[model samples]
Target: MDPTGNVGLLKCIYNIWKKPSKKAIIIYRWAKKMHDKNYKHIPIFLTNKLVVNYGSFISLNANIGRNLDFRHINGIVIGDGVTIANNVVIYQQVTLGGKNLGDFQKGNYPSIEDGVTIFAGAKIIGNITVGANSIVGANSVVINDVPANSVVAGIPAKVVKKLSY
Candidate 1:
């Protein structure tokens, strides 16, 4: 079989075998693939298992792009309708979720663009867009939109510095 065609399958198997800290991503990928293929029940079962095993709760409805890397996988919660682009790295205890308890407003979850890095203990809530190549510091609370190529830190996450291309 062609390697590129089976990349996801291969990666999932390998990650599970290696038992990496971010093995949950591979599991999520498999669940997402099953979900996309209309294999609903299996995905739900697998995701629930992953939540219990990995301590990472990723919604089946979350839209994620390729090459997502996790530094520490514990306590990572990604809510429904949240969008994460390619080459994004997320650390432990990060929450990308909505503001309210009940049903989320349309487009109310956080959108993480390409090349974004979210540090440990960061809580990115509400309908906000974290731009490409930006860095969210540890323990920061992001309630507003972050500009591209910027480094944000502290409570409410102010732009500490703008990165150059």
Candidate 2:
């Protein structure tokens, strides 16, 4: 839907056709749906193809909400068990994954809340929740929970600025 409350299927189709990021998301969504239904082989193949083509890997087991904008799809990685809410924009080379193989084995993953914008090369790891409406800076490494409506930066992702809205 547009700002004018208008919805057009043709416009959406055009977007999917023109945007590689949109096409990648659509492929992932379909593959995830198939994986959820216990139809494994094709989904795995499709996801693998995405990885090979886009250098992005979004685990089918990950729970992602609506309107996820893959700002730039290259080198993006979203691991299994991660949860992302609506209206999130993720830039290139961003990783949403557990800290180690042990954490992955334990199904520990980061949960990103709504309206968050993760900049390029940022790594959000461990069992932490990034609060809603927060901005994660480029190349930042987040290992802890981020408070709502804040901007975080640096190696450990300290809250550098608090947002009013």
Candidate 3:
């Protein structure tokens, strides 16, 4: 029947079958929708348990945009108060979290702008902004704000190259 070629429900189901990451994200989206509508309990379970079963921990409190792509579903953590924009690709073992776990204050999370790609095992901590079209290299520890259209790497990441376009 070529479900992948079909539109609407068929395509969605095909994607869920083909991609593990998509399956997890779909569950997250469903839970997030319920959370936004003030339907508690279920959303919490869905996010904490079901998503965790897939090996990802994405807080429902985080603000996320469209076209969020998780290349590898496992070992990804998106902390509360974090903001992620459209078309962001996050690989496995990537953590977008606060620097201080002791500080339970609001707005301590990082903000990821559109078209950002965070590679595997990268830890982006604190209340910094990862600008649009930026790429964070694998195993990098980013503490400072990244400018738009830049490529960063290494511990406490620094701009390695400035991208054009």
Candidate with best lDDT: 2
Give per-residue CA lDDT, model 2, range 75-165, as digits (tens): 9999998999999999999999998886766978999999999999999999999999999999999999999999999998999999996
Q: Candidate 1: deviation at residue 35, Å?
A: 1.4
Which residue runs of candidate 1 sit more than 4 Å off their true CA positions? 1-16, 102-105
lDDT of candidate 1 at residue 84, scale 0 to 100: 98
How high is the CA lDDT of each candidate model?
Answer: 0.90, 0.94, 0.90
For candidate 1, the 10 contiguous residues with the lowest summed lDDT are: 14-23
> For residues 64-141, what per-residue lDDT tens digits would candidate 3 score against the true structure?
999999999889999888899999999999999987874337578899999999999999998899999999999999
Q: Which runs of model 3 end up more than 4 angstroms from their true locations?
A: 1-12, 102-104
TM-score, candidate number 2? 0.92
Error of 2 at 84 (Å): 0.4
Model 3 weakest 10-residue run by lDDT: 99-108
In candidate 1, the residue pairs with backbone N, CA or C atoms under 3 Å apart (3 or more residues apart, or in different chains) clash, namely none
lDDT of 2 at 44: 95
Task: Please state the error at residue 31 of candidate 3 in Å.
Answer: 0.6
Off by over 4 Å in 2: 1-8
